[model samples]
Target: MGMTEKQLKSSNKPDKEMPLVQYENVTKKFGDVEVLKGLDLEIKQGEKVALIGPSGSGKTTIIRMLMTLEKPSGGVISLNGEPLWHKKIGDKLVPADEKHLRKLRSDIGMVFQHFNLFPHMTILRNVTEAPIHVLGLSKEEANERAVDMLNKVGLGDKLDAYPEQLSGGQKQRVAIARAVVMHPKVMLFDEVTSALDPELVGEVLQVIRDLAKETDMAMILVTHEMDFARDIADRVVFLHNGQIEEEGHPEDIFETPESERLQGFLSRFLNT
Candidate 1:
């Protein structure tokens, strides 16, 4: 599929001096278990970073924290250089109010491992609902934007179809369309292709690759697909024990990992 006019016009140009997302001394704990331990990370505008790790290595937790599904036990997350979990109250930082958090979170969008679609709504309606309500666009405007987004994901003909009518791959594409309709500055993809069959994973990954090429959104993906990560991500981060064990360009990380933990993790897939 050819890039849409909107995609053609989209630029990946980003401000080099400022990071689009920052995790500063971020920590998360549940009871006595620390899921994330004083981790720091940064994603520049238009950068694609993939988080890869063994199970329980805290890859998914990082994405969840960015989406505000979970709160940090310590430290701060910043979006566009402003605090995401806290609000400035006359030079003092305080936990953000609900209103403030919602406003700040509007710039982010997430896609989950499971396709979270409204079963009762048509594909088009599923995509349009958020823009109409959260973005306050008129119904007509939302519909137009939704249609364009669906087409971008190669689902223009499925607009009238319900969730059950689509295959697993198609449903995931619809989910991607729904998220893209909001035009989020940063997109969080948490094991997006993990739930699909082997044959179905390619189509969803293709959509993501196109998004990376066509738009400038900063994308953070937690994925097990090593080849896909190498192909799409500018940087690959291997997380272990709630921290970044090693990070570098895809070629460097995949070819010559310095950490024994990362080498062991990669060998499971690479040697196979």
Candidate 2:
């Protein structure tokens, strides 16, 4: 069935409004380089977004900010209509303390390209560690949830395996399972398939496709996979020189790009 059909069937949940995430006039800089320039974006709940652009266009940076890994140099970000960088109290933006950020983070998840699994831990342990340490889930509960997640990602039999025993694609899938175990409302994927071998890329992409189909969690992906982005994303955001050059439905962006920079960038990909 189409996404719209599925959306209609799952309409009983509390009204989670659109624009689950918002960046208003956001900017970021690295000394002499301005990575983000007055960027503004609104991402709705359950929207699957693919951010694409030339290298160093700040696609990854945007994900980092959403993950709270990098603070924005200017402007504000909000998640579920609450300030991500600050807490509002009586009309004033107070500095958001770590505790506050931690609470807010329960609604977000991130999966990076380089599967950041603990080398020493078994796959099951790696998956359960966060729930045990951060969310305070009991060992039994965490294990059950971890096993379910691993199975969901097609890693059920590999629970006893360590990171060293898994292939790159397997490791990436495990990382994805780990992130989703928390049932985050928003999932950030930063070039998750970029490091995979060409032959192995499909396995990882398939896993991600399952995730998109199974959950209502919103996802924002930074990726170079143009075809997949076009097929899956509800909207495609193209960043160039740290700014959003153009953004639209995949057909419009890829088939009839209005921006000169976008056309030039796509041309390079075509030549390759």
Q: What global local distance difference test value does model 1 have?
A: 0.89
Write model 2 residue lDDT over 1-272, tens digit each, in one string: 12233223323345456569988888999888899998888778898999999999999999899899999888888998899999888999987999889988999999998988899999999999999999999999999999999998889999999999999999999999999998899999999998889998999888888889888999999999998888788888899999888887888889998889999999988889
Candidate number with greatest lDDT = 1
Those runs of model 2 whose alpha carbons end farther than 4 Å from true positions after fitting are 1-18
lDDT of 2 at 237: 86
Every candidate's lDDT: 0.89, 0.89
Look at candidate 2 and give me any clashing residue pairs. Answer: 19-44
- Model 2 earns a TM-score of 0.92
How many collisions between residues are there in candidate 2?
Answer: 1
- Kindly report the root-mean-square deviation of model 2 from the true structure over all alpha carbons: 5.7
